[model samples]
Target chain A: MSTRRLFERETFLAPLLLSPVAVYMVLMVGFPFAMAFVYSFSNVTVGNPDFHMTGFGNFTAVLGDPVFRKSLLNTFIFTFISIGLVLILSNMLSELLTRQFRAKWLIRFLIMMPWTAPIALGTIGYLWFLDSVFSPLDWLLRTWGLLGKPHALLGPMSNMYWLGQPGLAMASVILVHVWRLLPLATMIRIAGMNSIPREIIEAAQVDGAGYYRRLFHIVLPLLLPVISVTVLFSTLFTFTDMTVVWVLTKGGPPDHSTQVLASFAFLKGIQGGDLAQGAAISLFFFPVLAGVAAVVLRIAKKAVVT
Target chain B: MANVQLIGIKKHFGGVKAVDGIDLEIKDGEFLALLGPSGSGKTTLMRLVAGLEEPTGGRIVIDGADVNDLAPRERGIAMVFQSYALYPHKTVFGNISFPLSVEKMPKAEMQKKAEWAAGLLGIGHLLDRMPSQISGGERQRVAIARALVRKPKVLLMDEPLSNLDAKVRHTAREELKLFQREINVTTIYVTHDQAEAMGLGDRIAVMHDGTIRQIGTPEAIYHDPANTFVAGFVGIPPMNFLEREGVVIGFRPEALLPAEAVPAEESMRLRFIVERVEDLGSHRLVYGTIGGTKVIANLFFRTPIAEGEERDFAVSNRDLRRFDLRTGERVRP
Candidate 1:
């Protein structure tokens, strides 16, 4: 009888318990998405409070611009390269971290320091570190005879214009993004590694699997779903990210080489005062991101460990 | 086939001695069961033999070569874990073919070997199915197939049938013994179930407190246990140890008989006050007290005995075993 009463209370109170989170989602996420949808279809701007519906005009204008096209491509390249590097480096580091070692907490803290720092602050620090004239990187490279003068095997060296050149600036942004995402990915991979049964690893060893064989066959295959999740999260974060590129290069170095969709949207919408085109530009992220997420989630489901 | 020799092998985890110094030899193609209760270091000893754990002290010799420095892969051994440890992501075929692929065996040869092993284990029809899609018994067969596919010199099994239901476990045990016989691989099987060890092992090593108390054939271990531990461990209802003067008298439940069934001159007789009788289909268990010691008798009769009735129970002198009171070691009369 008490259990039945508890059940009745649970049934009665479940929705009441859930309503706050539901309402919060509606206010925080749903409302913004709906507003963005409406703004994408209308010519809304800061100057004019009243606006009329526009039929694909903003999209057409945004897509017609070569800079917008370049931004789209840059966003894809940056997200892919950064996530790829994060996956590889974090997998290696997570494997090492999972092993028994002394001073492990210190190593973990050092690796996590960049991720724990505010992005803008960390990127600003990178900006100074990669400064062309007075960069510590340049100083180290010069000391190693890889910059500032000709050396054996290495061609004549000079100060690398890290953010001054288009290619170098893009690489720099991707590197920083990889550095920022690595700690989280490594943590996730470590959890995945720990979740695997120790008996399975021992069985593999007794079955005569060498180090690489055990890793690729047993460990990697079992960790597929977790790896997919890490990739999906990092990809989403890097794809729409504007902070690192904004603080480091601000989509500059001429010809808009390092510009990505999010930065491009911000530049045109808020700074350039072309709010309609910017809303349309940012809306482009939706379908592509959704498609990628769908594909990855399907893979994750298929590879889920039983 | 290879003989395995352990020479003072020891493993210490920090300060805990998981496996202390031990020495034993396993003849080629022998099925030796490491029987012990939990935390008795039987599994740790098996792991040390498989090269899963490094020994802190002595050497493990396989086929006359010391394998102390060899990696598990280099040791040429295969193990089936208690959980079965089937690769969940892989199909039955893929799981069985894992070791072959590691060796870079030709695809056709690997397929044949895997299929042959699956056929041997009677899981040939389920080769394409994922491990999760199969039943517990089928997964057990798949684990066996995977281990046997490599045809390693030595096989280690850590309670392989422990995860199966009782009904499946019996059948799996029968199949495992038959499979081991056919393969003739030197096998070390670890189990806490004395029934499993007795049914399958050629010789059973009863381990306790990080050391082997006795190693012998099932009959030898049962009829002439080296110590009180073995006598207590090997039987189902367990041997009853009644405190006597300088020693403890041990006797099986089956050794007790009705007073009238035994001659008065040949057997020791005791007065028992019947407390309860348990009907177990083919047999009945009579629980009673003799003097101050509680004693149970296995009676193969359906006749219900009244509770609180005093009766005489007789145990043959030949069936009685004695153990030292202090050391728990067996004492010959």
Candidate 2:
């Protein structure tokens, strides 16, 4: 075949192959995003099915709400705690796992079980486990002299308010988020450790580097790329998650505590009949996510991992 | 400098013995090469000496101090791995200064030692560059500099030049020899290459099947190999073997001569069909068969050799080695 004909044939077939994925992405992602953006600027409400252009009114009003402001702060606080805890706990766990031990695989399997279990199901289980009137932990604590009596564990004085109050509630949500995300981070770090050539480690050992010095000077620096990627992914997943909050607390006691941006947006659109305001609240999440992704990408690029 | 001794060292991985009851003494200021084929336990023996691996039984001593339980650092030995295991994240200077830093030496002293070692390896100018940013030869030099900067009494090298190309290996070999001579430290190097064993080792230990087959000076190991494995493993073309009277008779190709050049009364003549003539610049290798027994003879460059022709070669009785065919152990000189 002539070169021009061959080129033409390839070009003609290229889009045919790409069409399915393109159409799927549009249906799954592009369509909803476009709908949300358009609806945010319109006076769309569940109470009044009829809609008209409101031109940034939803954005201004959502920004003006004190609860919205509180949710934004809650979201940031939750994200910071969750991401920070995941980073630290996962690194420590991976360091422990990387050492020589009998039955190491069993420990790893148990550690990873939390990440693999269904999150909503796990949250529901936690909900029952910490129920004020019948909490097993409370009964045990009281029996063991750790608590005064088998009182309601989720009551205000029981410090379950950490999971039920505003700021502390956000911290509780962050803890759950970290529990759901730590396994993958640990696994990734372990894999990164395994990938380093044994000779390099031996060289370091012969150079008189103790275990901690070697870990800090050699292992951690080599693991930065993987750590960065894991942190970025965990940050995004934790930042946007609503299931734990929705299922555990339904976004509140008086909505005073436990209202993050994701749950607040769900409340406004699905339960509160303020669809435009909900879309506006959800859209605000994009810039924060994009900023995070940019920083992660920059850090990943600068890492000198080999 | 310290002498290292392996007292009946034995290492086992489950049921397989990697280094089985090996006993050796490497002297101070001597360059010793542990020569062997793959799976022969030379590398394992070197690792044991370096304290990278512990012996399952027996002990290792450096300067009369037992080191079997010591970590590599406490053993006071530096190793240059075959991979030139320089820290990829560190500059050449940082890599060379690692050992000194670990000992908490003053920064100025560490810098001076690092620079001097770098200069010795001819890598002084490359000290500021990361290992990944340099060429293989440069990286090899940097690894050497790192090992030398510590100035340990015993230096362990595991096939240090096996990663380089031919020309680079040759130059590195010479530089390594010069460095060892200048420093006068005891070095135990491991390699499968007999040429390197011959060139760099003050004493060459030919190893096979987790034991020392023979240990001697290069000339002794080359000219007086202990057994069939040593004979077959330690030469360029290797020793040639042929079955004779239910025994395997072997001889170096260079020991054979054209029948016409030998005195007919005293020399034995073996007639053969020439299969091929390999012209290797300064020498010619004649591949032939005598009574269906494959044999090879090496001749000078100017010899006329042709394929598919019958030729006769002579072997002196002293040059032939007779081994029991089944056991492959030397039977006669």
Candidate 3:
């Protein structure tokens, strides 16, 4: 009787069940954020190991560097382009994946390979693919007379120098990011597509709406909410991620052409021994992301089934 | 308006046959109800006609044209799903105008036609409301309005009213009947409810296990069933049967009456033992055994017999139906 009464206490059981998550949040998330906040406001470095309050110093130092500015610009360019491609490719893929096909399991598994495999492993694999001289992609272009040979397809050029060139390196980084993020977005979209009733789609077919008409008018409108969520998550992951850029380019050629805010911050704080500046640079995206998050939330709410 | 013909239509899902060898001809502007229990291929047959599913064999011809290769849009058809399937994101006006927009109709003309369709359904006042903002009944009208906006060759509906409350369904049924008459469009309505079929169908096709058992007017189907399945499926508490002499004798519960109440010149009498009675307000259901065969007698008038009593009951000669015991086919008298 005593144990039954104890178990019946809603007030006690609810908090008890939630304690582990609460503990994890405080220790894992809250503590790190608090430390970063303090470090951003103070002058702390790996060399000195001292906390001296110097408000705006780290922020000013980061803002003044041309490399920091270039990285800030690069981050936006990479994220937006990658997200744009991810949206288009993933939407088309989700549409195709939702329909019946032969060996669909293999296609889905292959599409998900980029995401399921370790990020470092995938990026390392890309290194061989984008190698300046030995890349099979360059070899294919050469065989097609597009990379080298006089008066070829893209004007005579030896090796194509994929990672060696500024423009090509940035493009390569964005493509890698798109490839990494696409499967997750496609899966989310497929789930959204499935949630719509089959009868509703059939109703559209009978109502004289053809394939394109149904896609634009009916399917896309209903999937708007889920798509917004997918875009938001992918945006956050891409904006704050350094893995792909780090492994493939490492902000190479000393020009910081493919440098993003996250990679730049890692370079400064963890590698360059300027812990204070790195924390400040890392926190730079907080306000921008927060603004984006607010807009997406509003859009998602409106897209919800009324 | 157009006529639809299904010539030996069959649909097989792997090893399972959802519809098998169904050949039905729907007259121009006629409302035909495909009636059957669930998994009886009524909906599958309807889908085949709508060009939603391609049959494993046979052809579907609408308005005298074979629509084997035609898409649903090219065939000119519309459907109201059981859920009413309104675009939750679009307002009623947007939904009604969607099909017209597909044709790239002039915006002004599209708006006018949509308003006209909405007016036909008396949903003109709800033009601006989103589907999620409307009631279930209103959403159904919007779905119908959308279907009608295009003025398609045929209209197909799958249990459109089964989602409504009982009180709402009655009025909606009345409205739907009136709307169908006013439009005079060829329609195929699929439903499992016999009452809905009887209320709406110009002719009802009763189906079972993938093949149609019978197709006729409500009066004909109720009065003359082709087989035991139709006889057993068409009515509530169904037709009671007693097997005797390699023949199955079936009669409606209402036909089984007290000996004195059945004033027919020739009647079959049975020694009935009362088990229990259910007072259904409008009628009493007499649950009892007749010649050791469990039977139900629907009596409009109260009887004096109580539980544990044995009495004489009779079925009028005209009301008795006989079927072959082995085949369950009605044996011609």
Candidate 4:
């Protein structure tokens, strides 16, 4: 009958607690997603969003193009390479951080700096760090006489043109993204490592299992469920990511070498003003991410045990 | 099997001395129970012997070999941790055979040894099951079996039976005593339970404040304690203390009984003011104050007693232990 009494009801309180998030998702995410789905099947342009039911015309046209094909292949290569490096580096870093040391607090704070800082802001900082003429990396190489020297390993180029050459640009993009995503993966790994009981490690030692044996047989096997969950989340981030490609190379060097699905979709829809084609291009990423999300949820369930 | 001698062993975690200046020697094929309350360094001393904790100052000699710098695996020791610490990911067979696998024993020999160990513990049927699928008592047995599988020089048990139910613990205590005798390996078992120490140990070392207060056969330690700490620690309801002038005297609860029970030739009478009485299954614990100091009397049979009643109790002269009033150390006559 009154405000407080009305809120006391379980049915009323439950929906009230959920309404803000539900409303935001339906308006912001749900509306755009529905529009994209419709646009992908219709002929819609930026200048004239007058939609006509075209029935997969945009999808077939986009698929036939060579640039989109190259971008699609490039997306897989970029994602897989970056995630591989992230996995190895994060595992090593987690092991180092899990041990007790004098500098642990300082080291942990510095290790988590990238994740705590905004992704877009960090990428902008990298824009200068990997510039063509002014990159500190090339400056160091030149200062060491490695790049400008005639018989040097990098060879007679005064500058490496980090963002100009197709291969170098792709490499730069992959490395930059690896650096950005590493802190998150490493934190997950550290949390996983901490959850294992200390007595188990000591028991292995007393049982005559050496250091590496304990790690491989005891630590790693117990860490599998956690590692799988970390891998799943990392996969989703890399698969849907466009910011690194956009900020570092703009999917560029003319061959579309570093272009991924997310970046190319933005280029085609918003910048190239072919909204219908861009919508169709991005639709390709949905099924892959959905599959990954499903696996992650399943692993998350298993990871909760022990 | 080997004798373990810890000479002035000390383990300091920063400023906290978990185990400080302890000297103890356990003989080959002997079962020594380290008995103490928590923070008494009983567990820390066992961990030091297991090589799990590094000693700050001491030499650990196992069969004349200095093992202070050696890793636990290199020291030829096996331990059953308080939590059992079974490899959750491994099956019972895998858990038992892990050490053999580390030794690089032949696959057939390793499996045979593992099966033998499991069978000895009556857990052969659970070999295919993972640790999570087993009950707590079975898990404890599996841990013990894993430790015994390798037949190391010394076996250290850190409250291994503490996790089991009361009925299971009692059965485990009996089985463990039998297992130790059969194996005839030197053992150092750490526990806070006096009953466990009394039941399973050939010798019980009572510890307090990082140092061993007394070490002797269970009968000797109980009958003749080195100090007040041991006398008070190793008995249920502990020993009662009464200070008079400069002398501190302690007597066991069972030692103080009705005047008719004590022998007349060595009798000392005291006026006891009864405050409460607790009826245990086989005994009645009489609570009272003798000359304003609290004392308990464990009476095995029913007696005519009431609260707030003045009663005369007797203690035999031989049963009373004398101590130094200032330091609480036993002062023998």
Ranking by DockQ: 1, 2, 3, 4
Better of 2 and 4 by TM-score: 4
Candidate 1 vs candidate 3: which has greater DockQ?
A: 1
Candidate 4 lDDT by residue in tens digits, A1-306: 999999899999999999999999999999999999999998888998587899989989999989899998998898889889998899889888888899899988888888877888898888898887788988999888889888988989788888898898889898888988889899888888888999999999888888789888998788888778777878888888999889888899887878889999999999999999999999998888888778867776664255
Categorize the docking of model 1. Answer: medium
lDDT, candidate 3, A68-171, per-residue tens: 99999999998999999999999899988988999999999999999788988999888999998789898999888886888888658778778998999999
In order, the candidates keep a fraction of the true contacts of 0.91, 0.82, 0.84, 0.86
Chain A TM-score vs. truth, each candidate = 0.92, 0.88, 0.93, 0.93
* Tens-digit lDDT track of model 2 for A32-125: 9998999999999888989899998998899899999988987887788888888889889988998889999899899989877899998888
The alpha-carbon lDDT assigned to residue A154 of candidate 1 equals: 37
Q: Give the candidate order by descending TM-score.
A: 4, 3, 1, 2
How much DockQ does model 3 earn? 0.67
Q: Highest TM-score, which number?
A: 4
What local lDDT score does residue B46 receive in model 4, on the 0 to 100 scale?
A: 89
Error of 3 at A252 (Å): 2.5
TM-score of candidate 1 to 2 decimals: 0.91
Task: Say which prediction, candidate 3 or candidate 4, comes out ahead on TM-score.
Answer: 4
Give TM-scores for every candidate, taking all chains together and pairing residue i with residue i. 0.91, 0.90, 0.92, 0.94
DockQ of all candidate complexes: 0.72, 0.68, 0.67, 0.64
Off by over 4 Å in 1: A1-57, A142-161, B302-305
Model 1, A11-89: lDDT tens digits are: 7679878999999999998997787788888999878888999988888888889999999999999998898899899
TM-score of model 3 relative to the true fold? 0.92
lDDT of 3 by residue, B1-333 (tens): 899999999999999999999889999999999999999999999888888999999999999999989988899888888998888888899999988988999999999999999999999999999888889888889999999999988999999999999999999998999889999999999999999999999999999999999999998898888889999999988898998778999999999988998874789888889899888888888899887899988888555657787888999999999999989999997
